[model samples]
Target: MGLGACSTQGPFEEKDRGPDRPVDTSHVPDAVPRHEVRTAAGNKNPYTVLGQTYHLMDDETGYREQGIASWYGKKFHGRRTSNGEVYDMYAMTAAHKTLPIPSYVRVTNLDNRRQVVVRVNDRGPFHGGRIIDLSYAAAQRLGFANHGTARVEVEIIVPGDQPPAPLRAEEASDAVAIPSGEQTYLQVGAFSTLGAAEQQRERVSGMVGYPVVIHSPEELPELHRVRIGPLTNTTEVAEVREQLRRNAIEQTHIVKE
Candidate 1:
Protein backbone atom coordinates (compact mmCIF):
# COMPACT_ATOMS: atom_id res chain seq x y z
CA MET A 1 0.00 0.00 0.00
CA GLY A 2 1.29 3.44 -0.88
CA LEU A 3 1.84 5.85 2.02
CA GLY A 4 -0.03 9.09 1.46
CA ALA A 5 2.49 11.86 1.29
CA CYS A 6 2.41 14.32 4.18
CA SER A 7 2.54 17.77 2.65
CA THR A 8 5.55 19.89 3.44
CA GLN A 9 4.20 22.20 6.11
CA GLY A 10 5.23 24.21 9.13
CA PRO A 11 7.79 22.88 11.54
CA PHE A 12 6.53 20.46 14.17
CA GLU A 13 6.58 22.19 17.48
CA GLU A 14 7.10 20.24 20.69
CA LYS A 15 4.32 21.09 23.09
CA ASP A 16 5.11 22.32 26.58
CA ARG A 17 5.51 19.39 28.96
CA GLY A 18 5.84 19.59 32.71
CA PRO A 19 7.88 17.45 35.03
CA ASP A 20 7.03 13.79 35.50
CA ARG A 21 4.07 13.31 37.79
CA PRO A 22 3.21 9.94 39.35
CA VAL A 23 -0.18 8.50 40.18
CA ASP A 24 -0.38 6.56 43.41
CA THR A 25 -1.96 3.23 42.53
CA SER A 26 -1.57 1.96 46.07
CA HIS A 27 -4.78 3.64 47.19
CA VAL A 28 -6.79 2.36 44.24
CA PRO A 29 -9.80 0.27 45.38
CA ASP A 30 -11.02 -3.24 44.49
CA ALA A 31 -8.88 -3.07 41.39
CA VAL A 32 -7.74 -6.26 39.78
CA PRO A 33 -4.07 -6.76 40.40
CA ARG A 34 -1.62 -6.63 37.54
CA HIS A 35 -1.46 -9.95 35.70
CA GLU A 36 -4.29 -11.10 37.98
CA VAL A 37 -7.02 -11.23 35.34
CA ARG A 38 -5.62 -12.76 32.17
CA THR A 39 -8.34 -11.37 29.90
CA ALA A 40 -10.92 -8.62 30.19
CA ALA A 41 -13.61 -11.21 31.15
CA GLY A 42 -17.03 -11.17 29.49
CA ASN A 43 -15.60 -8.59 27.14
CA LYS A 44 -16.56 -9.48 23.58
CA ASN A 45 -13.84 -8.52 21.10
CA PRO A 46 -15.62 -5.92 18.91
CA TYR A 47 -14.47 -4.65 15.45
CA THR A 48 -16.81 -6.27 12.95
CA VAL A 49 -16.88 -4.11 9.80
CA LEU A 50 -20.53 -4.60 8.85
CA GLY A 51 -20.04 -2.82 5.50
CA GLN A 52 -22.26 0.08 6.41
CA THR A 53 -22.57 2.99 3.99
CA TYR A 54 -20.29 5.96 4.64
CA HIS A 55 -20.21 9.40 3.06
CA LEU A 56 -17.14 11.32 2.01
CA MET A 57 -17.16 15.01 2.87
CA ASP A 58 -15.73 17.47 0.38
CA ASP A 59 -14.05 19.19 3.30
CA GLU A 60 -11.67 16.49 4.52
CA THR A 61 -9.63 18.71 6.78
CA GLY A 62 -10.04 20.44 10.16
CA TYR A 63 -9.59 19.88 13.91
CA ARG A 64 -12.04 18.21 16.32
CA GLU A 65 -12.64 17.57 20.03
CA GLN A 66 -14.41 14.68 21.80
CA GLY A 67 -15.16 13.33 25.30
CA ILE A 68 -13.31 10.89 27.60
CA ALA A 69 -10.64 8.34 26.64
CA SER A 70 -9.45 4.89 27.82
CA TRP A 71 -6.98 2.14 26.78
CA TYR A 72 -6.29 -1.64 26.31
CA GLY A 73 -3.56 -4.26 26.58
CA LYS A 74 -2.51 -8.00 27.06
CA LYS A 75 -5.39 -9.81 25.38
CA PHE A 76 -4.60 -8.35 21.96
CA HIS A 77 -0.86 -8.04 22.07
CA GLY A 78 0.97 -9.37 19.03
CA ARG A 79 -2.24 -10.40 17.27
CA ARG A 80 -2.81 -9.37 13.66
CA THR A 81 -4.79 -6.13 13.84
CA SER A 82 -7.30 -5.01 11.20
CA ASN A 83 -4.48 -3.07 9.53
CA GLY A 84 -2.50 -6.34 9.27
CA GLU A 85 0.22 -5.14 11.68
CA VAL A 86 1.02 -6.94 14.92
CA TYR A 87 -0.45 -5.41 18.11
CA ASP A 88 1.85 -4.10 20.81
CA MET A 89 -0.22 -2.76 23.75
CA TYR A 90 2.94 -1.47 25.42
CA ALA A 91 4.08 1.15 22.91
CA MET A 92 2.55 4.59 22.77
CA THR A 93 -0.45 4.14 20.48
CA ALA A 94 -4.25 4.38 20.16
CA ALA A 95 -7.39 3.15 18.27
CA HIS A 96 -9.97 5.06 16.25
CA LYS A 97 -12.77 3.98 13.90
CA THR A 98 -12.78 6.48 11.01
CA LEU A 99 -9.68 8.64 11.06
CA PRO A 100 -7.30 8.29 8.12
CA ILE A 101 -4.44 5.89 8.63
CA PRO A 102 -1.25 7.49 10.05
CA SER A 103 -2.81 10.83 10.97
CA TYR A 104 -1.52 12.81 13.94
CA VAL A 105 -3.54 14.16 16.89
CA ARG A 106 -2.70 15.89 20.10
CA VAL A 107 -4.44 14.26 23.05
CA THR A 108 -4.83 16.31 26.24
CA ASN A 109 -5.81 14.97 29.64
CA LEU A 110 -8.24 17.49 31.12
CA ASP A 111 -7.92 16.44 34.72
CA ASN A 112 -4.22 17.10 35.30
CA ARG A 113 -3.47 19.05 32.14
CA ARG A 114 -1.15 16.73 30.24
CA GLN A 115 -0.88 16.17 26.51
CA VAL A 116 0.57 13.56 24.14
CA VAL A 117 0.85 13.44 20.37
CA VAL A 118 -0.43 10.20 18.83
CA ARG A 119 -0.45 8.82 15.31
CA VAL A 120 -3.78 7.59 13.99
CA ASN A 121 -2.93 4.30 12.32
CA ASP A 122 -5.88 2.00 13.02
CA ARG A 123 -9.62 1.91 13.79
CA GLY A 124 -11.84 1.35 16.87
CA PRO A 125 -12.71 1.80 20.55
CA PHE A 126 -16.22 1.09 19.26
CA HIS A 127 -17.70 0.66 22.72
CA GLY A 128 -18.74 4.32 22.68
CA GLY A 129 -18.02 7.41 24.83
CA ARG A 130 -14.34 6.88 24.07
CA ILE A 131 -12.53 8.70 21.32
CA ILE A 132 -9.16 6.96 21.59
CA ASP A 133 -7.75 3.78 23.16
CA LEU A 134 -4.20 4.21 24.37
CA SER A 135 -1.51 1.65 25.16
CA TYR A 136 -0.17 0.87 28.64
CA ALA A 137 2.77 3.19 28.15
CA ALA A 138 0.70 6.05 26.77
CA ALA A 139 -1.86 5.67 29.53
CA GLN A 140 0.90 5.91 32.08
CA ARG A 141 2.11 9.16 30.55
CA LEU A 142 -1.41 10.59 30.85
CA GLY A 143 -1.77 9.27 34.41
CA PHE A 144 -4.96 7.32 33.64
CA ALA A 145 -3.72 3.78 34.31
CA ASN A 146 -4.39 4.56 37.99
CA HIS A 147 -8.00 5.63 37.59
CA GLY A 148 -8.68 3.48 34.52
CA THR A 149 -10.18 6.45 32.62
CA ALA A 150 -9.94 10.19 32.23
CA ARG A 151 -11.68 13.13 30.57
CA VAL A 152 -9.65 14.12 27.50
CA GLU A 153 -9.55 16.42 24.51
CA VAL A 154 -8.45 15.29 21.02
CA GLU A 155 -7.52 17.75 18.27
CA ILE A 156 -6.38 16.78 14.81
CA ILE A 157 -3.08 18.05 13.34
CA VAL A 158 -2.66 17.86 9.60
CA PRO A 159 -0.25 19.29 7.10
CA GLY A 160 -1.07 21.89 4.40
CA ASP A 161 -4.50 23.43 4.02
CA GLN A 162 -6.50 20.21 4.19
CA PRO A 163 -7.54 18.88 7.57
CA PRO A 164 -9.90 15.96 8.22
CA ALA A 165 -13.53 16.83 8.71
CA PRO A 166 -15.33 16.16 11.97
CA LEU A 167 -17.43 13.02 12.35
CA ARG A 168 -20.79 13.91 10.85
CA ALA A 169 -23.92 13.60 12.99
CA GLU A 170 -25.12 10.55 11.06
CA GLU A 171 -21.68 9.03 11.08
CA ALA A 172 -21.09 10.00 14.70
CA SER A 173 -24.52 8.74 15.72
CA ASP A 174 -23.96 5.42 13.99
CA ALA A 175 -20.56 5.23 15.63
CA VAL A 176 -20.37 3.38 18.95
CA ALA A 177 -20.91 5.12 22.29
CA ILE A 178 -19.73 4.52 25.83
CA PRO A 179 -20.99 1.70 28.16
CA SER A 180 -20.41 -0.73 25.29
CA GLY A 181 -17.11 -2.59 25.46
CA GLU A 182 -17.12 -4.17 22.04
CA GLN A 183 -15.70 -1.22 20.06
CA THR A 184 -12.63 -1.60 17.89
CA TYR A 185 -9.25 -1.29 19.64
CA LEU A 186 -5.62 -0.31 18.90
CA GLN A 187 -2.43 -2.07 20.10
CA VAL A 188 1.06 -0.57 20.28
CA GLY A 189 4.51 -2.07 20.63
CA ALA A 190 5.78 -5.40 19.28
CA PHE A 191 9.08 -6.40 20.82
CA SER A 192 11.31 -9.24 19.69
CA THR A 193 11.82 -10.57 23.21
CA LEU A 194 9.50 -11.23 26.14
CA GLY A 195 12.03 -9.67 28.47
CA ALA A 196 12.00 -6.40 26.54
CA ALA A 197 8.22 -6.23 26.62
CA GLU A 198 8.24 -7.09 30.29
CA GLN A 199 10.61 -4.25 30.96
CA GLN A 200 8.13 -1.79 29.47
CA ARG A 201 5.27 -3.39 31.41
CA GLU A 202 7.25 -3.06 34.62
CA ARG A 203 8.02 0.55 33.84
CA VAL A 204 4.35 1.43 33.41
CA SER A 205 3.11 -0.63 36.38
CA GLY A 206 5.23 1.42 38.72
CA MET A 207 4.03 4.76 37.33
CA VAL A 208 0.26 4.38 37.33
CA GLY A 209 -2.77 2.50 38.70
CA TYR A 210 -3.02 -0.30 36.14
CA PRO A 211 -0.72 -3.28 35.88
CA VAL A 212 0.75 -3.86 32.45
CA VAL A 213 0.40 -7.36 30.95
CA ILE A 214 2.51 -9.29 28.45
CA HIS A 215 0.43 -10.58 25.55
CA SER A 216 1.80 -13.36 23.36
CA PRO A 217 1.56 -12.23 19.75
CA GLU A 218 -0.04 -14.65 17.28
CA GLU A 219 1.16 -13.10 14.04
CA LEU A 220 4.42 -11.65 15.26
CA PRO A 221 5.64 -14.75 17.05
CA GLU A 222 9.03 -13.19 17.62
CA LEU A 223 7.43 -10.30 19.52
CA HIS A 224 5.93 -9.79 22.97
CA ARG A 225 3.50 -6.92 23.73
CA VAL A 226 2.09 -4.81 26.57
CA ARG A 227 -1.35 -3.13 26.53
CA ILE A 228 -4.15 -1.47 28.57
CA GLY A 229 -7.97 -1.76 27.87
CA PRO A 230 -11.08 -2.17 25.72
CA LEU A 231 -12.42 1.37 25.87
CA THR A 232 -15.54 2.09 23.81
CA ASN A 233 -15.98 5.78 24.61
CA THR A 234 -14.06 8.17 22.37
CA THR A 235 -14.31 11.08 24.78
CA GLU A 236 -12.76 9.13 27.62
CA VAL A 237 -10.09 7.73 25.39
CA ALA A 238 -9.01 11.16 24.17
CA GLU A 239 -8.81 12.57 27.67
CA VAL A 240 -6.76 9.68 28.97
CA ARG A 241 -4.29 9.96 26.10
CA GLU A 242 -3.59 13.58 26.95
CA GLN A 243 -3.00 12.82 30.60
CA LEU A 244 -0.59 10.00 29.73
CA ARG A 245 1.40 12.41 27.59
CA ARG A 246 1.71 14.92 30.41
CA ASN A 247 3.13 12.30 32.72
CA ALA A 248 5.58 11.18 30.01
CA ILE A 249 5.54 8.52 27.25
CA GLU A 250 4.73 10.90 24.36
CA GLN A 251 5.60 8.89 21.26
CA THR A 252 2.23 7.20 20.59
CA HIS A 253 0.04 6.12 17.71
CA ILE A 254 -3.54 4.93 17.10
CA VAL A 255 -3.98 1.40 15.71
CA LYS A 256 -7.27 -0.12 14.55
CA GLU A 257 -8.38 -3.24 16.37
Candidate 2:
Protein backbone atom coordinates (compact mmCIF):
# COMPACT_ATOMS: atom_id res chain seq x y z
CA MET A 1 0.00 0.00 0.00
CA GLY A 2 2.60 2.54 -0.90
CA LEU A 3 0.81 5.80 -1.46
CA GLY A 4 -0.42 6.29 -5.05
CA ALA A 5 2.02 3.74 -6.50
CA CYS A 6 5.70 3.39 -5.72
CA SER A 7 6.28 -0.27 -6.52
CA THR A 8 4.49 -3.49 -7.41
CA GLN A 9 5.46 -6.94 -8.59
CA GLY A 10 3.14 -6.35 -11.51
CA PRO A 11 1.00 -3.65 -13.12
CA PHE A 12 1.42 0.14 -13.32
CA GLU A 13 3.12 2.33 -10.75
CA GLU A 14 2.07 5.95 -10.43
CA LYS A 15 1.30 8.77 -8.05
CA ASP A 16 -1.67 8.14 -5.75
CA ARG A 17 -4.37 10.21 -4.05
CA GLY A 18 -7.77 10.00 -2.42
CA PRO A 19 -10.89 9.91 -4.53
CA ASP A 20 -12.20 13.25 -5.73
CA ARG A 21 -15.36 12.61 -3.74
CA PRO A 22 -14.04 10.23 -1.16
CA VAL A 23 -16.41 7.80 0.47
CA ASP A 24 -16.36 7.86 4.25
CA THR A 25 -14.78 4.61 5.49
CA SER A 26 -14.86 5.41 9.17
CA HIS A 27 -17.04 2.42 10.00
CA VAL A 28 -15.63 -0.13 7.61
CA PRO A 29 -15.73 -3.58 9.19
CA ASP A 30 -12.45 -5.38 9.70
CA ALA A 31 -11.46 -8.27 7.47
CA VAL A 32 -12.22 -11.40 9.41
CA PRO A 33 -9.24 -13.61 10.15
CA ARG A 34 -9.58 -16.94 8.33
CA HIS A 35 -7.43 -19.80 7.17
CA GLU A 36 -6.70 -18.82 3.61
CA VAL A 37 -4.58 -21.11 1.50
CA ARG A 38 -1.53 -19.26 0.28
CA THR A 39 -1.16 -19.01 -3.47
CA ALA A 40 1.81 -18.51 -5.77
CA ALA A 41 0.37 -15.44 -7.48
CA GLY A 42 2.22 -13.06 -5.19
CA ASN A 43 4.31 -15.28 -2.96
CA LYS A 44 7.50 -15.32 -4.96
CA ASN A 45 10.46 -16.29 -2.81
CA PRO A 46 12.82 -14.00 -4.70
CA TYR A 47 11.29 -10.93 -6.28
CA THR A 48 12.80 -7.71 -7.52
CA VAL A 49 11.25 -4.31 -7.01
CA LEU A 50 12.87 -0.95 -7.62
CA GLY A 51 16.30 -2.60 -7.92
CA GLN A 52 15.92 -4.34 -4.55
CA THR A 53 15.25 -8.05 -4.13
CA TYR A 54 12.82 -9.28 -1.49
CA HIS A 55 11.95 -12.78 -0.41
CA LEU A 56 8.40 -13.55 0.63
CA MET A 57 7.92 -15.66 3.70
CA ASP A 58 6.42 -19.14 3.30
CA ASP A 59 3.95 -18.17 5.98
CA GLU A 60 3.34 -15.42 8.51
CA THR A 61 3.65 -17.57 11.59
CA GLY A 62 5.14 -15.71 14.58
CA TYR A 63 5.67 -12.56 12.49
CA ARG A 64 5.57 -9.35 14.48
CA GLU A 65 7.29 -6.02 14.08
CA GLN A 66 6.95 -2.32 14.79
CA GLY A 67 7.67 0.24 12.09
CA ILE A 68 6.23 3.01 9.96
CA ALA A 69 3.17 2.31 7.76
CA SER A 70 2.02 4.12 4.64
CA TRP A 71 -1.15 3.69 2.57
CA TYR A 72 -2.44 3.48 -0.97
CA GLY A 73 -5.57 5.12 -2.33
CA LYS A 74 -7.50 6.07 -5.48
CA LYS A 75 -4.53 6.05 -7.79
CA PHE A 76 -4.40 2.28 -7.82
CA HIS A 77 -8.06 1.68 -7.20
CA GLY A 78 -9.52 -1.13 -9.31
CA ARG A 79 -6.09 -2.12 -10.56
CA ARG A 80 -4.88 -5.68 -10.01
CA THR A 81 -2.58 -6.08 -7.04
CA SER A 82 0.44 -8.32 -6.99
CA ASN A 83 -1.75 -11.21 -5.85
CA GLY A 84 -4.32 -10.81 -8.66
CA GLU A 85 -7.05 -9.31 -6.52
CA VAL A 86 -8.43 -5.98 -7.69
CA TYR A 87 -7.16 -3.19 -5.47
CA ASP A 88 -9.95 -1.52 -3.59
CA MET A 89 -8.74 1.44 -1.62
CA TYR A 90 -11.81 1.24 0.56
CA ALA A 91 -11.28 -2.42 1.48
CA MET A 92 -9.63 -3.72 4.62
CA THR A 93 -6.60 -4.97 2.75
CA ALA A 94 -2.88 -4.24 2.67
CA ALA A 95 0.45 -4.87 0.98
CA HIS A 96 3.48 -6.39 2.57
CA LYS A 97 7.00 -7.13 1.41
CA THR A 98 7.65 -10.53 2.96
CA LEU A 99 4.53 -11.86 4.63
CA PRO A 100 2.80 -14.68 2.81
CA ILE A 101 0.14 -13.64 0.36
CA PRO A 102 -3.32 -13.49 1.98
CA SER A 103 -2.02 -13.31 5.53
CA TYR A 104 -4.21 -11.59 8.09
CA VAL A 105 -2.35 -9.05 10.20
CA ARG A 106 -3.40 -6.95 13.14
CA VAL A 107 -1.97 -3.47 12.75
CA THR A 108 -2.05 -1.18 15.78
CA ASN A 109 -1.38 2.48 15.28
CA LEU A 110 1.19 3.29 17.93
CA ASP A 111 0.29 6.99 17.93
CA ASN A 112 -3.39 6.55 18.80
CA ARG A 113 -3.73 2.90 19.83
CA ARG A 114 -6.26 2.37 17.05
CA GLN A 115 -6.08 -1.05 15.48
CA VAL A 116 -7.41 -2.90 12.42
CA VAL A 117 -7.03 -6.36 10.94
CA VAL A 118 -6.09 -6.16 7.30
CA ARG A 119 -5.69 -8.94 4.78
CA VAL A 120 -2.35 -8.78 3.03
CA ASN A 121 -3.05 -9.38 -0.65
CA ASP A 122 -0.30 -7.51 -2.41
CA ARG A 123 3.42 -6.77 -2.31
CA GLY A 124 5.17 -3.51 -1.86
CA PRO A 125 6.11 -0.58 0.10
CA PHE A 126 9.49 -0.30 -1.51
CA HIS A 127 9.96 2.99 0.28
CA GLY A 128 12.47 3.34 3.06
CA GLY A 129 11.38 3.03 6.71
CA ARG A 130 7.85 1.78 5.90
CA ILE A 131 7.02 -1.74 6.95
CA ILE A 132 3.53 -2.20 5.51
CA ASP A 133 1.27 -0.55 2.96
CA LEU A 134 -2.35 -0.28 4.03
CA SER A 135 -5.47 0.34 2.05
CA TYR A 136 -7.10 3.76 2.40
CA ALA A 137 -9.93 2.28 4.45
CA ALA A 138 -7.51 0.36 6.63
CA ALA A 139 -5.55 3.53 7.35
CA GLN A 140 -8.76 5.37 8.10
CA ARG A 141 -9.85 2.73 10.60
CA LEU A 142 -6.42 2.94 12.27
CA GLY A 143 -6.89 6.75 12.62
CA PHE A 144 -4.02 7.70 10.31
CA ALA A 145 -5.51 8.21 6.86
CA ASN A 146 -5.26 11.97 7.04
CA HIS A 147 -1.66 11.95 8.25
CA GLY A 148 -0.49 9.69 5.42
CA THR A 149 1.81 7.61 7.66
CA ALA A 150 1.92 6.30 11.20
CA ARG A 151 4.20 4.28 13.44
CA VAL A 152 2.52 0.94 13.98
CA GLU A 153 2.99 -2.59 15.23
CA VAL A 154 2.11 -5.40 12.81
CA GLU A 155 1.40 -8.81 14.25
CA ILE A 156 0.41 -11.96 12.42
CA ILE A 157 -2.94 -13.39 13.49
CA VAL A 158 -3.55 -17.13 13.31
CA PRO A 159 -7.28 -17.59 12.85
CA GLY A 160 -7.37 -21.28 13.61
CA ASP A 161 -5.67 -20.74 16.95
CA GLN A 162 -8.19 -18.16 18.18
CA PRO A 163 -11.07 -19.39 20.28
CA PRO A 164 -14.44 -19.04 18.61
CA ALA A 165 -16.42 -16.07 19.88
CA PRO A 166 -20.05 -16.70 20.86
CA LEU A 167 -20.72 -13.18 22.17
CA ARG A 168 -19.08 -11.07 19.50
CA ALA A 169 -19.98 -10.39 15.93
CA GLU A 170 -18.86 -13.06 13.53
CA GLU A 171 -17.18 -10.50 11.28
CA ALA A 172 -15.16 -8.86 14.04
CA SER A 173 -11.86 -10.25 15.33
CA ASP A 174 -12.12 -8.23 18.55
CA ALA A 175 -13.64 -10.68 21.03
CA VAL A 176 -12.95 -14.38 21.51
CA ALA A 177 -14.58 -17.44 23.05
CA ILE A 178 -14.22 -18.41 26.69
CA PRO A 179 -11.12 -20.29 27.75
CA SER A 180 -10.36 -22.91 30.38
CA GLY A 181 -7.54 -23.15 32.89
CA GLU A 182 -6.26 -19.65 32.16
CA GLN A 183 -6.53 -16.16 33.59
CA THR A 184 -7.97 -13.51 31.33
CA TYR A 185 -9.26 -9.94 31.17
CA LEU A 186 -11.81 -8.08 29.14
CA GLN A 187 -10.05 -5.32 27.25
CA VAL A 188 -12.60 -2.67 26.39
CA GLY A 189 -10.18 -0.50 24.52
CA ALA A 190 -6.70 0.98 24.22
CA PHE A 191 -5.41 4.50 23.73
CA SER A 192 -2.13 6.25 23.11
CA THR A 193 -2.60 9.14 25.53
CA LEU A 194 -3.22 8.75 29.25
CA GLY A 195 -6.09 11.22 29.17
CA ALA A 196 -7.99 9.23 26.59
CA ALA A 197 -7.35 5.99 28.45
CA GLU A 198 -8.55 7.50 31.70
CA GLN A 199 -11.74 8.75 30.11
CA GLN A 200 -12.50 5.27 28.81
CA ARG A 201 -11.56 3.82 32.19
CA GLU A 202 -14.18 5.98 33.93
CA ARG A 203 -16.90 4.92 31.51
CA VAL A 204 -16.02 1.21 31.56
CA SER A 205 -15.66 1.15 35.36
CA GLY A 206 -19.17 2.47 35.82
CA MET A 207 -20.51 -0.02 33.27
CA VAL A 208 -19.03 -3.33 34.49
CA GLY A 209 -18.29 -2.68 38.21
CA TYR A 210 -15.17 -4.81 37.77
CA PRO A 211 -11.64 -3.83 38.73
CA VAL A 212 -10.90 -1.66 35.75
CA VAL A 213 -7.31 -0.58 35.32
CA ILE A 214 -4.98 0.93 32.72
CA HIS A 215 -1.74 -0.78 31.86
CA SER A 216 1.07 0.31 29.57
CA PRO A 217 3.17 -2.70 28.81
CA GLU A 218 6.95 -2.38 28.77
CA GLU A 219 7.15 -3.50 25.18
CA LEU A 220 4.70 -0.77 24.10
CA PRO A 221 4.93 1.93 26.73
CA GLU A 222 2.91 4.35 24.63
CA LEU A 223 -0.17 2.09 24.73
CA HIS A 224 -2.71 2.77 27.47
CA ARG A 225 -4.86 -0.34 27.77
CA VAL A 226 -8.22 -0.27 29.54
CA ARG A 227 -8.94 -3.71 30.92
CA ILE A 228 -11.47 -5.21 33.34
CA GLY A 229 -11.07 -8.26 35.53
CA PRO A 230 -8.59 -11.06 35.92
CA LEU A 231 -11.46 -13.52 35.64
CA THR A 232 -10.18 -16.80 36.99
CA ASN A 233 -12.83 -19.06 35.50
CA THR A 234 -15.19 -19.27 32.57
CA THR A 235 -18.17 -18.64 34.84
CA GLU A 236 -16.79 -15.30 36.01
CA VAL A 237 -15.89 -14.39 32.47
CA ALA A 238 -19.44 -15.12 31.32
CA GLU A 239 -20.94 -13.11 34.16
CA VAL A 240 -18.84 -10.08 33.34
CA ARG A 241 -19.56 -10.49 29.66
CA GLU A 242 -23.32 -10.60 30.35
CA GLN A 243 -22.99 -7.34 32.26
CA LEU A 244 -21.04 -5.85 29.38
CA ARG A 245 -23.79 -6.87 27.01
CA ARG A 246 -26.35 -5.23 29.27
CA ASN A 247 -24.29 -2.07 29.10
CA ALA A 248 -24.28 -2.28 25.26
CA ILE A 249 -20.56 -2.90 25.01
CA GLU A 250 -19.88 -5.24 22.11
CA GLN A 251 -16.28 -4.59 21.13
CA THR A 252 -14.73 -6.43 24.05
CA HIS A 253 -11.50 -8.37 23.52
CA ILE A 254 -9.98 -11.19 25.55
CA VAL A 255 -6.50 -10.58 26.94
CA LYS A 256 -5.06 -13.83 28.19
CA GLU A 257 -2.27 -13.13 30.63
lDDT of 2 by residue, 114-159 (tens): 9998989988787777898898888888887777888999999987
Instruction: Write model 1 residue lDDT over 1-257, tens digit each, in one string.
Output: 00111111100111211113432211111111111121322112332333332222233257577687766555455555445555555445566555554455778899889777665544555444666666545666778765556899977655433343354332344434654435333233446568777887776556544334666746546446565445555654554345555555533333335
lDDT (C-alpha) at residue 161 in model 1: 37
Q: What local lDDT does model 1 show for residue 194?
A: 80
How does candidate 2 fare on TM-score? 0.61
Cα distance off (Å), candidate 1, residue 235: 44
The local distance difference test score of model 2 is 0.75
For each candidate in turn, the TM-score is: 0.44, 0.61
State residue 71's C-alpha deviation in candidate 1, in Å.
0.2
- How many collisions between residues are there in candidate 2? 1
How good is model 1 by TM-score? 0.44
Candidate 2 backbone collisions, by pair: 4-16
